[model samples]
Target chain A: MAHFEKASSITEWLDQRLAITTVKKVMALEYWIPKNINFLWAMGMVLAFTFALLTISGIFLLMYYQPNVDTAFDSVNYTIMSEVGFGWLWRHIHGVAASVVFLIIYIHMFTGIYYGSYKKGREMIWLSGMLLFVVFSAEAFSGYMLPWGQMSYWAGMVITNLFEGFSPDIAGGIMNAPGLVEWIRGDYVPGQAFLSRFFMLHVLLLPLVIIGLIGLHFAALRIPHVNNQDGEEFDYHEAAKLYKEGKTKESKVIPFQPVFLSKDVFVLGVYLIFFFYLVFYHFNFAMDPVNFDPADGLKTPAHIYPEWYFLWSYEILRPFPKDPGLIAFGFAQVAFFLLPFLDKSDTVAPANRRGLFKYWFWIMIVDMIVLTVMGKLPPQGIWNHIGLVAAVVFIALFVSLPWVTKNENRA
Target chain B: MKNELKILGVVVIFTAILYWGVEPFAHTQMHKHVDGEHFAYSDLNESTKKGNVENGKTLVMGAGACTGCHGIQAVAHKAPMDAATAVSAYGVNPPDLSTAGGLYSEKFLANLIENPAHALKVEHKFDAAKGKMHPMPAFYGAGGDKAQEIADMVAFLKSIAPKEISPKNAYLDACGRCHANRYGKLDQLGETPTFKSETDTLKHKVAVLEYQDKLKAYMGKLPPDLSIIIRARSEHFLETFVENPQSQLEGTSMPRVGLSAEGFEKVKAYLTQTGDPSKTAREAIGPWVLLFTLVFTVLAYLWKKSMWKDH
Candidate 1:
């Protein structure tokens, strides 16, 4: 142990024991941020805000939500929406946050890729962020099942069936895909067992995991610091020292507090305006119309599609025959995590400064949008061909990344 | 700054394309728009346009005999039988007609008065395949063939109806007997009755179940609750389907309840209220919330500028 100073006040007393002053210094006040970053850097804070909103609203919803199959639909549609005061407001906030968080995640993700934030020493940041993304996806999927509605039932059915891809022939016996599905569902179909388990995962297990992963995600950021738009590397310690010495204009970095937080607050204010607009007036996109119908095992809806966030991968899985589609989907899910290794370019700069990488980035984005659009459409006629082409392009783009970036030089 | 503009431009273009593909383009591909003209009851519309309300009232009270099973609450025209007796006889309670004028289309009412089976589009139930007759008989006893008399009856119902009926009242009067509004706290028989005793509650429960069973048998399936129907269906589809059930779903058990355009609007409002009750408050508070955020953003921008002024 080191020598301790005598405490003078409550904060001082607490700091003597808990290192409160050190924590505040390390986490916020003395934390250095690149001054060259733009509004996109604020997305991380926005996502944290959204997660807080989701957790709070989810707790409120859990108070009224019944997990039993017989009563779950009515509990959500009637009891929560009609009976509970401000229940609809909580629901709207939860719903819009759930959806809009994904939009921000995608933007945050692409921003990282464009700025080469996942390269060199920043791999852990990318890896931890991807882990958080996966956990968030699981949280969203499990929460979706709580409604016990037509879309909920069918989407659950379709997604769980993906486990079937694991079953393979072995020694004159077929592995039971159906049996695995039954074990996961706790029945042959989605019912009381499915509902209860998903409810537990959504409310308790997954949320705890998400909170833990979020901490890790931020922790991973501390070591590498944040990447700048220009991808210009400099000594952060020297820049921070210069900022401290009142040479703020000469310094390339600024303290995270006051300076960085001001810009973040401005971005958050803008983001909230967009978010509340959706929450209040245009929430239909977040809550599917077909989901209003109670779950029926026998009656399948005319069209079934996952939420928009998952559409790009869903489209990738759609056009190909089962096994091939499954393989492609598996690839798409893990592809982003492999970005650090796949982009062979030595330079760490914005895509605009990289020759072929710029085109690659833009094409990847357009291809993803195309896949998402095709995913929602009925896979027939012209749409089938378009989806097939888009899916092919998606896989081809990932496969070509290494070759495209290998010979590229910083512009 | 140039890079920010470039990013913004890209984002705007990308979002616009995505919206077009998802909303308008996807919609056209998924649902084929049904033409309302195909289901329009032209002759009935013409007759109702020139109906005599006084003559309609006399016919309903005397010869039309609508008062035999149905009650017009606004005029104190009670049904001849009690609800229990009516349920046993017709397998469903006859809805009150106090708001029928505001709840149903004139054409639908005129057609229903003339031929319940034909107007409701449940002709399949009475055909040789099913070998069953509708509980409500055709109005053959009094000017049933005369379209003018049927139109007059509709006009009378309309005349007696309250000018400004609530959405809940409109839904209960028009559809409550056959369909439940579960989210709105209504059973198949409108409001769930509160009984003073456990036995009375038990009796009500049994009656409701029995009524639902009878309805299932009569129509091949119990009607779905209308709590979320507004969200589940598009306005055009609902309008066309209400006008004539067979036009959208061939051989659907649902009758063409023929709501006049105004009645459909009220029913839709009720459904929307139940399905998305927070819509009103959400929309009302949206502008203020946006304004507050805008002001905060401006203030934040100014603070950011001031903080960076030294740098």
Candidate 2:
């Protein structure tokens, strides 16, 4: 791509010094994405839009949301809902988007799994994306608690209480000191300090970190080049060089602008339709009824269910009583962070190769859905047993992925 | 490629319009309310004045004419005029008030009785059908003498409840009529109580509706589950609201639940406990399932093994 060609005076001035146009020409206009990607490829764009919407809406909501034990619940219920001109819309977007972003990221994760995008050189991309997911979850959980509703207060207490697992009781001797939960909560329970700290993480800290990670994720994806269905690398710079040398057919890449950009926008429009539909029509669809009730430290909601996205791990948290269950819960998330290393198939695509891996992957999805449903269902009777099997299968799928992939038939 | 940018540009503009224009419009369309349109559960403060339960029963049963509409087993006053008859004059049936103190937050109940139409419109987003205001007439006017009468009525309504009624049954009887009960669907190992008479059967039918199914939203507000009301609102505030709600929030539709001070105590306890009826059961289930999952891991490991033959 030729830069500074028939440039306007302003473009020439900027390009002559800062090279702003030059950077855009390289990264934006001339950037090449693989031509043979699907609607799944548009997920990155949807995530970016969701993240942006969350930030924008979150900022507006923060203007109204009072981060105090006294005011947090009502700020959302009254001030945000009735006081602010369009506070309801923004609050709903931020609140509902918490679940939607996770929904998008889950699909994004499954897409990675389906195409094996996490394998080989793209490990950093996968790692950062997984980090985003993990951190994003922390962000959502913290924000969910900020409303200081019954669920928020209880969930905040329940989650912070998970740190109690660190305090091991051996022969009646405690290993870790007490108040680990208090330390995180900044009090005996979720109160003033919990709300303040969560407000910071939800709006500022976690988002900033995620923004940095998303940059790294995009950088890693672009640098080694985008992974595709075939699992073969096609370097855009090399392809560009070949095209300049009249070996254009060998260069199977198109500039991201017109090709990927349009698809991403189209996808963004489609994504926003569903996203705003939740915000507008089904705004409370993802919200639990208990959250509408104000927070009460003395009372815990009968079933301490996390939002739907966290249900997979929450289900995994169940069935392992005490320290063992806590350990299993901790290890469940560790599976995703360890996924790239756990899955070592030389063949990238799970299309035909990864036979056993594919079978188990669907089972994993089914298992996760069951686990999610079980998480919402009161833990009793046959449901508990069903949840138990689902949890075992959940961990088993990840545990056996590497070995299963090794044994799977190759393409 | 040029066409692609055009499409992208169009999409970007379309989504922008949808976000700024369509969504907010739709949201505003559905909900037309002002800031502080309704009070937060926590914002309400309870009155410290001790209510007299004896005074409450006298006000309700003696001169209040409360039995003209509401049914109270404790008072042995089942109004001769049923809902069907009342609809001709009142525009809506006066709901059975047997468990009024039990179901409603005291403050909500107080507001409703003091100003029937206003309380429902504000707190519950209640709308009177056919342009008629709420069926319940305002018993306590703005006159100075009305305070004791209002308090006495609330206290009297409060006195009708069974002490330590299981939170689940309380919800079924009081709140189950309007808000949906998620717990009602849970498979109960316990036996249903047997009702002996025609009146008992009707009450049982209404209770069953609340056992687990959801009620339609009143106006825009989902007649909210009282399961968490105790945790949601303080007992004092709950009772104070029921004593005379219009004093705190004008234009609330919830009729004052005419419960005595003793009745208020019993109902408040019941509403709060419903927040976590299965607390112990849920927590206990966690450990047993964990043990089962560990045992099942062996079976799952074998199942994974069977999926492979050569290796």
Candidate 3:
């Protein structure tokens, strides 16, 4: 032990002209991480780690994949079914990690929202996190077409076609322009063009924007005090002074030495086991075999669904009748991003709500679940219309939340 | 620590089972095939020649394997090609039989099938331009009633041809798609063959080039590339070959291509050749490829840097 310290001496410091250990501390330390964070709080870490794995796997995929119609499907199959050592595992991991990343991010956001983590002190961080969610979603959307499979082809067709639903005149012009339509198609339809452009966007562009936002999110959050379980902001100086005074007495600081660190490691290990299970055995996670066929623009996939996590949001948007002016759909759809604003009440606890707000919150949750189920099932008539009515009514309730809260506080 | 270790062990075993042990059960969703409904084999007959196209869908579905070579559009089936892998595999033009009746009368198709050589008009502009077209392979080797069956299929195609369009005009329209002024370039309108319109260009190119060897020899001293030869050959030379192949040169091995007088004239006038400009320039080669590579590399590097920078 004496020799171990002696070997790490002045000569090593002199060679660099500064302590080498300082660089390690700067790089490796998570100084901004909340000390009180529990297993639920670890979702962000898991997602971040998964993002890294996805990036690494994505690099390998770019090596052999071809995007053109003739070779696009064949090349992906070659990668998965034939070429490379255990290429199927790589494909499965990349695919599952996509779903997993969204899942974790959603849970993290939900936790943050419920805890009022976006309260004035951390609004910028919350806003950045929300923006990152959208960026990652677009990344997933672009990446979906990279497989050039039946689902990828048709889903891309349906979604890109929605840009037309925004402005028919513009959509018609864009759809008619040989070059523009071809560009949207990745050329002529689900073949090389779609696959190649989507691959570049997925692997490079989306990740860059997401990472930058995530950095800002953390930096902004660091400047404010982290919210505690009791919802009281920590006055760090007062807390530190009290802790030092109590050090001679029976003090309480969760030590990094054994107890909490070991617990975190154990939880992480369990989480990873779940992660690896999905990666290896449940390799078929959400990706359909039929999607292995190249995209034919004329032939839409019989059933179109978004990634599973977005099924709730996609469900909410589905119910509005197409004939209604854009306001109906636009208002219903925009509610998701506007959720942070909608749920703004001084009270974070659900149990304390005196009147309709609590019931409405439960109704919204149920509506979301119903929409999620609807997102998976094929469209039906009267029932689907009823679902849409419910969505509209719930949206109204959500929109009126701030006013309702003000009235209740005055009473 | 012991409880933590036990929890960790359970997690590992659970994960291992979930990852490696789950049985992959096969499930077939009610996926609708793009091709239509099936027909029974018992429905096969001479009368089946007038069969419903909807019922003929089974001929191309799973186990039918018809989709392999024939494209989704059967009448205009062209092999799909990737730009990078198989540029020549899908030729610039393929035959269009959308309006065959206008280009060749029913009797002409019959005689042509029976004897390709006698039916073809031999063109021998010079001895070098005298390569006979390979005899079209018989639909049934050594001949039988398969000829009639093939004729029936041709009739089926003819039935589907749009009522308003002529074969020559349809062929012209197809040709004028990429080469807008193909027929307009023919100086000697009466002497040279040309498409009446752009649509029939593919049909004319295919029919004219069907005599590939003869066409090659005809342009021997001029441009070597077929793409370019169409541009170089004068209206008169092209016209003579279409009008009377054997009469133009003695010892000419060229077979007559039984084109109607109007069809022959239209195709000859329309066939202008041009070479792909990219191949001839040596200096542009390095820089063009390098430019794309640089852009791609720079984009890729920026992407990577941005993605990992935050992490």
For this target, which candidate reaches the highest TM-score against the unseen true structure?
1
Instruction: Provide chain B's TM-score, model 1.
Output: 0.85
Measured with C-alpha atoms, the lDDT of residue A190 in candidate 1 is 90
- The full ranking of all candidates by TM-score, starting with the best, is 1, 2, 3
lDDT of 1 by residue, B164-280 (tens): 989888888778888887778798866998889999999988878888887887667888988888877777887788777787888888777777777778878888898777778
Q: Using DockQ, give the best candidate's number.
A: 1
Candidate 3 segments whose C-alpha is farther than 4 A from its true place = A1-37, A165-192, A241-264, A323-336, A348-360, A407-411, B1-311
Q: Can you tell me the DockQ of model 1? A: 0.73
Cα-based lDDT at residue A174, candidate 1: 50
Per-residue lDDT of model 1, residues A149-234, tens digit only = 99999999999888865436532335336477888999888988999999999999999998998888899888888999788889
Query: Lowest summed lDDT over 10 consecutive residues: which window, candidate 1 chain A?
Result: A167-176
RMSD, each candidate, Å?
2.8, 20.2, 19.5
- Candidate 1: deviation at residue A367, Å? 0.7
Please give the lDDT score at residue A266 for candidate 2: 59
Residues B166-256 of candidate 3 have per-residue lDDT tens digits of 4335335333322233223321011125568876876656544443333233433211112223323333444554344444443454444
True contacts kept of each: 0.83, 0.03, 0.00
Native A-B contact fraction in model 3:
0.00
- Comparing 1 and 3 by lDDT, which wins? 1
DockQ of each: 0.73, 0.04, 0.02
